[model samples]
Target: MYQLAPNIDLLFTEAGDAPDRVRAAAAAGFNAVEMWGPTGKDIPALKEALEETGVQLTAQLAEPRMQFMIPPKDHAPFYTGLDAGVEVAQQLGCSRIVVGSGTGFGGRKRQDQLDELIEIFTRGVAHIEGSGITLVLEPVNIRVDHPGALLDRTSEAVYVAKGVNSPNFGILYDLYHSTVEGEDVAAELANAGDLVKYVQVADAPGRGEPGSGSIDWPARFADLRNSGYTGPIGLEYYPTIDSAKSVRRIQELVAGR
Candidate 1:
C-alpha cells in the first residue's frame, strides 16, 4: 500500500496557517503533508509544528516561480530562488522540491523551448548538488488549469529529466493533469517509468476529491502500481466538502482497504 500526503495548502486550511495545518493533519491521522512556496511562510513555526507532530514534509515548490520563456530569459534569479528553496527544505527535513515550466514564449519552436528547459534544470541539478534533495519537474495541464504553459505533457517532462540525467533528478507525474490532457495513465506511466520520482492526484471534470469526479481511481491505482512507482501519493486537491471527509475515498483506495 502507498502513503498519502495531504496538500496542506488546500487540504487542511480550515485548521489555520501552515503550522497549524500540520498539527490538524496529524490529529486527523495523516503522517505526511506537502506544501507550496516556502517564502512568506513562518518557517520557524512551521518547522516547530512538523517536529512536534512528527509529520513528514514530502515536498515544497521552488520560490519566485520562473517564467523562463519570457523575455531575456535571465536564469540567475531562478537559480537563487531554487537555492533558497533548498535551504528551506533542508530546515524542514523535506526530501523533494517541485519545479514547473512556466508559460511559453510565442514564435519559439516547441523543441527549442523544451531543450531550453533541459539546460535550465540540468544546471539546477548541478547547482544544488550534495543537498540530498531530488528535484521533481512537474508537467501541468494547459487545457484546463495552466494556459500556455510550456511543459504540459508527462512525456516531455520525462524528456527533460533524461536530459538532466542525474540520479537525484526526475519528474513529478500528476494524475489529474494527465487525465485532463487525455493521456492514457498506463501509457504515460510506462513512458515515465522509473524517472517518475513523485506523484500528485485530484479528480477530473471537477478538481475535487476521489469520489467527486469521473476519474476511475481504482483503474488508475492499478496502473500506477503496475508501473512500479512506490512513492507516496500527494493528495493535492480542493475539497468540495469538509477536508477530513473529502479524503476518505482516496485514503481507502491508496490503502487498498
Candidate 2:
C-alpha cells in the first residue's frame, strides 16, 4: 500500500494549529504529514509533537513563496529562505522542500524566464549542498487555481529540472494541477520518471477530497504505480466534510493498492 501524507495546512484543520494538526494526523493513523511553509510556524512545539507522535513530515514549501513575483526579483531572499527552510527541514527530519515559479519577469521571453529558474535554483541548491535534502519545483495550473503562475506544465518543470541538472533537484508532479491543466497523466509521468521526486493530489473541478470530484482516482493510482513513483502522495485538498470522513475514500484506495 502507498503511504499517504495529509497536508496539515488543509486537512485536519479542525484539530487547531499546525502542531495540533500533526497530532490529529497521527491519531488518524497517518504517520506522515506535509505543510506549506515553516517560516512562521512554532518550530519547537511542532518538533515536540512530531517526536511525541512519531510522525514524519513529508515535505514543506520554501519560504517567501512566489518570490519572483515581487519587485527587484534579486531573489536573494529565496536563497536565504532556502537555507532557513533546510535548517527547519533538518530539525524536523523532513527531506523535501517544494518550490514554485512565480509570475514571469516583465516582457522577458518565456523560455528565458524558465532558464533563469534553472540558474537561480542551481545556486539555491548550492546553499543546501550535502544537507541530504531535495528541492522539488512544483508546476501549478493557471486555468483554475493560479491564473498567472509561470510554470503550469509538467514538461516545463521537467525542462527546468534538467537544466538545473542536480541529483538534489527535481519536479513535484501534482495530480490535481496537471488534470486542471489538461495534461495526460501517464504521459507526464512517463516523461518525468525519476525527476518526479514528490507528488500532490486534489480532485479537479473543485480541488476537494479525492472522491468529491470527477477524477478517476483508481485509474490515476494505477498509472502512478506503473510510473514507478514510490513516494508519499501529499493529500493537498480541501475537505468537503469532516476530515476523517473526507479521507475515507483515499484510505480505501490505498488499502486496495
Candidate 3:
C-alpha cells in the first residue's frame, strides 16, 4: 500500500502548535508526517509528541530561507545551513530532505546557473555520503505560488539530478507544480525514472485536497506505480474543511489504485 503522509505544515494549522499538529495527525490515523522546516518549532515537544504517537517523521526542508544554490559563491552558506538541517533531521529521525533551486540569478546565463546548481548538489551529496540522508530537489510552480523560482519544470529538475549523478541526490516529483506548469504528468514521471525520491500533491487551480480540483488522481497514481516509486506520497494541500475529512477521498483513491 502507498503511504500517505500528511504535510503538517499546511494541513493541521488549526491544531495550534507543532506538537499539537503532530498529535492531531496521529489521532487522525496517519502513521507518518512531513513538515517544511524545523526552526521556530519546539523541537523537544515535537520530538516527544512523535515518540509518544509513534509517528515517523518522513521529511523536512533543507536550509529553509537560504538560497545557497542560486549562485556559486553562496555555496558556503548553503553547506553551513545543510549541516544544521542534517542535524535536525537526525534528531527527528527523518531520512529525506527537500531542496529547491533558488530564483534565477540576475544577468547570468541559465546554463551557467544550472551548472552551478549541479556543482553545489554534487558537493552536498559528498557531504552526506554516509549519513543515510537523501536530498530531493523540488521544482516549484512559478505561475501560481512561487514567481521567479529557478526550477519550475520537472524536466529541468531531472536534468539537474542526472548531472549530480549520485544515489544520495534525487528529484521531488510534485504533481501540483507539474500540473500548474502544464506538463504531462505521466510522461514527466517516466522521464524522471528512478531519480524521483519524493512526491507531493495538491489539486490544480486551487492548492486544496485531491478531489477539490481537476487532477486525475487515479491516472496519476497509476503513472506513479508504473514508474516504480514506492515512497510516501505527501498530501501537501490546504484543506477546505476538516483536514481528516479532506483526505478521506484521497485515501480511498490511493487504496483503489
Highest TM-score against the true fold, candidate: 1
Across residues 43-119, which tens digit of lDDT does each residue of candidate 3 receive?
Answer: 88988999999999888998655564443455677788788889888888999999888888777887887887898
Better of 1 and 2 by lDDT: 1
lDDT of 1 by residue, 1-257 (tens): 88789999998899999999999889888999999998778999999999999999999998788999999888899999988999999999999999999999997999999999999999999999999899999999999999999999999999999999999999999999999999999999999999999999999978999988999888999999999999988999999999988887788888776
Candidate 2 Cα RMSD after full superposition onto the native fold (Å): 1.3
- Candidates' lDDT values, in order? 0.93, 0.91, 0.88
| Candidate 2 lDDT | 0.91
- Mark the regions of model 3 whose C-alpha exceeds 4 Å error after superposition: 68-72
Model 3 Cα displacement at 24 (Å)? 1.2
Model 3 steric clash total: 0
lDDT of 1: 0.93
Clashing pairs in 3: none
RMSD after Cα superposition, model 3: 1.5
Cα deviation in Å at residue 110, candidate 2? Answer: 0.7
Candidate 2: Cα lDDT at 150: 89
Candidate 2: stretches off by over 4 Å: 69-71
